[model samples]
Target chain A: MTHQDVVAQLIKLVEPYAEGRVAHITANTGLTGELALDSLKVMDLITDVEDHYEISVPLNTLADIKTVGDLASLIQKHVGNDA
Target chain B: MKENPRLLAVRAVRQELATLGIDPFGIQIDEILSPTEGLIQGRRTILAGTNNYLGLTFDPDCIAAARDALESAGTGTTGSRMANGSYAAHRELELDLARFYGKRDAIVFSTGYQANLGMISALAGPGDTVMIDADSHASIYDGCNLSGANTIRFRHNDPNDLAKRMGRLGAEASHALIVVEGVYSMLGDRAPLREFVEVKKAFGATLLVDEAHSMGVLGEKGRGLCEEMGVLGDIDYVVGTFSKSLGNTGGFCVGDSDEMEVLRYASRPYVFTASLPPATIAATRTALRKLAAADDLRLRIRENAARLHAGLAALGFRLGAPANAVVAVLAGEKVEALRFWHHLLKQGVYVNVMVPPATPGNESLLRCSVSAAHTPEQVDAICAAFASWPGARV
Candidate 1:
């Protein structure tokens, strides 16, 4: 999948946990700051994304993820590597 | 002016508690009257959060053993086991624990936290991977951090997630160490040990089960989940604490692996910390023997847990898990949980208050632990206290 496709799917996966802050979510949205997602919520989001994409997102790879755009990029990279 | 990050966090938490008009942490129990009752805030309170599963804390034999040891061994062990602290009692307890679990070797640590810290850090190192449950206790997380291993967390209690993660690692999966708990303390749920064993065998990875909550609470012989699930021989390491069922203070790791003995020399947590006092060691030894034969206590605790769990659920409370000794009542918001905890305390009952980040799913929990020693009347009182909560039935 393309990066934009990854971002769109990511937004949908995280929206429910966003707690009515869905409108604030975008490619540039910060998972912690903008969405106010705690570590546990972030982990749930990561798990959902992994299951949806059928790809592995190692915890170490999540260290560099600060924004939705970064997460999308990471997912895309993993998908590409998987393919 | 710059402020310490830790202090800032503490201030924020304190402000929230102050607004809620409750202080649930570090509560002072002026007197422990029995295994199930205590004097808290000048009131006779039922202690439903002590995690004294077998209720042997005040057993006459245990008390006598502790006293005799205190008189003979004096007050403290001033040195670490690696130094002058490996007293005869410590070694004897280790041997007894090894035999109790039917394992070839066992190593004792001063506290349960150190058991996980020492075992995980010593078992997995650089170039290795540590796969743990997302809801694992903090000690396990700390151990992973100290291991210098690439750590990954699978969805809690989901063996499929663990299998998939292990598959993704390919060759490195062989070097992975999968860790899980026998009975999770917060939610009182159990891991799918049988399924996990299959995954571990498939991936050629080692499995470590922390039975801190299950020891003396499960299995015919009280050897924990491994024995209860008929997977004792398959588990690579079984770690547990004496603070819970044994009602003493210490931790141990027992296994059949020859490498287990090397941890005595390698684990810093074990080598550096002072050994448990002679009195504690003596008491734990007695407790262990008693626990092995007290199948009736196990049955009584489960019965008490069922009574309490059903009572709370009937009163319109959402439970985190099923009927277990550790019955966690789900309270949606932190403030709501604090209110419930305070209400229970005022009604002469006490339970643990678990809040965000510490509790999984960002949920708040009023964690109630049942003990074998609690009378049926005490259980009824505990239930009635919850039933009496304001708008509880509504």
Candidate 2:
């Protein structure tokens, strides 16, 4: 998957759980400060992503997942497509 | 003083609860006389929220043992275990725990939290790695933090993910400690210990099983999940608590050989903190003996839990995980959860109102822990309360 594709999928996955404002979470949006996805929601989102993609996402990689763009990049590295 | 983030967060939490028409800090139960009863709002409330797994808190033997120690040893240790805290009872409980688990050594901590904090931090340091279940208790997470280890969380109860993560760790995997709970506190689901043992062995990672919620509730002799799974010899460390099943207040870590003994000298949580009170140690020793013979109590608690879970599931309430002792009623949103909690409380059933940050999946939950002392009528009352809740039909 390309970065754009992964970003799109993550955005779609996170839209329902994001409390209103993050419905339009862009690829460059910061997860905590920008999109307002707190730690619990982020963990829930990570679980969903793992289930959907059938991949294991390490908790240590959370440092790189600060932004939606960073998440997309990581997903691309794992799932082999950005989207 | 300028507004502080922590204080602001607390205020925000209060405001948020008020917005939802619920009090976040409501319902303080001042004095709990028995494991099954509490005084709340100047009224007697059924104590279903406590994890008194075996209901041995008020046992005559336990009480007498604690009393005897109180008379003999005075009050608190007044010093760390490394100093003046190593009483005869402390060493006795440690030896008794090691013998009970068939391990070479056991190290007891003042509290269950400290056991995890000390053991995990002592074993896994800055260069070492600690792989944990996503659903692991907060103590495990905090322990990892104190260790400054490279911490990674795998999916809950997913050995495949654990193995995959282990496979990815080229060299560090060998030294990693794969931590999991024998029985998860929230969902009351047992870890697939056999699968974990297999993957842990294949990856050459050490296994540490926290039996806090399972020590007296799982195995025949109440030795915990390791004994139940017949893999007691395989797990590197078995960490457990006297607070829940044992009906006392302390924690312990037992392991084969002298490795755990080293934790006594090395663990900062152990070395720096005051030891378990003499009365607590004495009561726990007595409780351990009772737990070993309290097969009937274990069976009753299990049966009660099963009945409650089945009844709640039948009532159409959304339940989390396959219930064992802990039955979690899933409330999707926080408001409905707080509302439902008040409804249950009004019905005279006291349960844990676990909200976000504490609950997994960002879910809100009403968690009930069944005890051997809870009569069938009480369980039925709990079930009936849920069954009668508006739109709560299964």
Candidate 3:
């Protein structure tokens, strides 16, 4: 799957907790702002994402990942199968 | 599949720091002098960020006790308590702590962190649950994690939220250990002990209050929130540390003799970790003894905290919680927080800089922890430094 496809999947996962359009989760969309989720909630989301993709996103990677696109690229780069 | 998100996260943290024009982690203090003063960047600074609440670290009585212990007991235990490490001083300290709290028993640990870790983990296991406040210290979270129990958090200082979560536990709720702090670390707000006690009683759940920051800072004679709130006997467990107000390093769990005594043998963290050193036990004993009658010091400390809070508030800086020993200034973003911290350091005042991951909702904070040793002038100096900073208000 492409980076966009991965972003779409992750966006869907967080959509239930988010506002407006999931597609608006751009490369610069702050996860905390877009989803109105706290740190622990984001941690829970990351756990779900890790389980779904079978890829490990380190704590450092989380610091770098602000938007959906950045998250997708991280998964792609690490797991080599982003979606 | 081979990549490690953990290492990547560290690198990402470095990258993020670069982008934000700050350092995620930097600087090292050669020595921390006092709660109101320390040496940073080769300059003497007013230390307003340390959790040295009672200012007993440099007390003559405490220092003499520690010195005597060092001469008598050496530097370390160098072995777990279950091994050959439980010294006479350790047992005496435990007994003293129990008597001080008016509890039947008290179990001591190497550090405050391990006290929660050992007590919470041992009391509640995989099948049980640990309910904590969202604003609890990291040690509490670590304890819950170590327990292998299902952990849940209630909203900060909200008894209703705690009740709602307890209701979900159903019959298994009795096994849940509801934990909270007397004075929260970040915001410096006291827990609603009476309401929380009522809620815990209603649910038939056990309770544990970490008085790490409140031990000698509240209550008549400094017994902490339980005594001050008049719910001391009703609560199941009272856990606290000597590091903060007591001005030493160690942790203890005090409660009814029958149940708390069992933890001495059952808790892995307590049994496995080397016993606290003689010096710590000795100094802590002196501190605890003085604590039971140190109303004057507690009053002065409270006055100092209030003075700082009122001063900061007057300057239009958004203070955290109420006028308490801890005064947190909101900084919104990491870059701005770093800049504010740097500015404080340059002004010869040292405060803690907390940002995302560590802080709730990734909100950056400049936290100032007050102590009894802080004079009115020092408090005024700190406030003046903060007011002088243009970047701090935002």
Candidate 4:
């Protein structure tokens, strides 16, 4: 999947947990600031994204991700890679 | 002039507590009346937050043992175990703990926090990986940080996530150390130890179960979740504290592996810190003996836990997990939780007011720990206090 496609999928996955904040979710939206997602919520979002894409997002990968765009790009990179 | 970071942090915390209208930190109980009751703020309060699970803090035998040791052995050890410490009582307690868990070796530490810090850091080094639960206690996180290993957190209580993370480690999976708690301290939920054992075995990862909350509260002989789940032998390390069920202050790590003994020499936290006082070791030894045979105390605490959990749930309070000794009542907002906690205190009941990011899920919790010493009437009074709180029911 393309990075933009992954971002769209991420927004949908995080919407229910974000408490109607999906309207503000975009590629540049900060996961913690704009969406007010805590570490646990971020983990939940990661789980949902992983299950939907059938890929494992290593926890270490989350360290460098700050915005929806960063997460989307990471997910895109891992989508089909066996690692 | 640039603002001092320390002062800035203190002022920020003070402002936050001022806004909440309650100071829940470092509450001083003017008098501890019993194992389960105390005088707080000049009012008699039911002590529901003290993690005295077996209620042996005031047990006659334990107190007597402590007194005798204090009288005979003097006060402090004055040095680390690697130095002038390692009194006879300390080694005896280690032997007792090792025998209690049916493990070959046990290493005692100054506190439970140090136990995790020492064990985890000593086990996994720069070349290794440590996989822990997302909801693990701060000590575990600090331990992982100290390990210098590439740390990864799997979703809490999810073995599939753990397995996947281990799989992602590729050839390094065998060097991974999987850490989880027998009973989580905050939410009072248990790890699926059986499933975790399977994952550990499949990945060839070493398993460490911190039984700080479960020790003397679960299993036939109260060895903790590993024993209760019938997978005691599979657990590579069993870490626990004496502060909870044993009613003292110290920690231990017991395992059958020969490498466990090397931690005594290699673990910095253990080598550098003063050993537990002679009195604490004596009292813990006494408590451990009682814990091995105190089935009645275990039953009472469990019964009390069930009563409090059921009563609170019936009153429309959101619970964090199941009806365990550590029953966490969820208050979605920090301000509301502070109000609920203050109201309960006013009603002669005391519980922990936990706020994020200290609590999991950024949730606020009125964490209640049940004890065997609490009477059924006292449990009802605690329940009634929660029931009467306007914010809690909502």
True contacts kept of each: 0.43, 0.36, 0.04, 0.29
- How well does each candidate superpose onto the true structure, as a TM-score? 0.94, 0.90, 0.84, 0.90
Per-residue lDDT of model 3, residues B1-79, tens digit only: 6878659767877887787665626756667776567787798988887778888889899999999999988999899
**What's the true lDDT of residue B80 in model 2?**
91
**Can you write out model 1's per-residue Cα lDDT over B178-208, one digit (the tens) per residue?**
9999999999999999999999999899999
lDDT of 2 by residue, B319-341 (tens): 88776888888887777888888
Scored by TM-score, the top model is 1
Per-chain TM-score of chain B, candidate 2?
A: 0.96
Residues B1-394 of candidate 4 have per-residue lDDT tens digits of 8888759757887788888778888678999999989999999999998999999999999999999999999998999988885798899999999999999999999999999999998998776789899889989988977878777778899999889878877888988899999999999999999999999999888999999999999999999999999999999999999999999998999999999778778888998898888889899999999999999998998899999999988988889889999999988788888888999999999999898877887678999999999999999999999878764354
Model 3: clashing residue pairs? A58-B5, A58-B6, A59-B9, A60-B9, A60-B10, A61-B9, B36-B47
DockQ of each: 0.49, 0.34, 0.07, 0.31
Top candidate when judged by DockQ against the true structure: 1
Residues A50-74, model 2: lDDT tens digits: 7688665655567757888888788
- Candidate models: Cα lDDT each: 0.90, 0.85, 0.82, 0.89
Please give the C-alpha DockQ score of model 3.
0.07
**What tier of docking accuracy does candidate 2 attain?**
acceptable
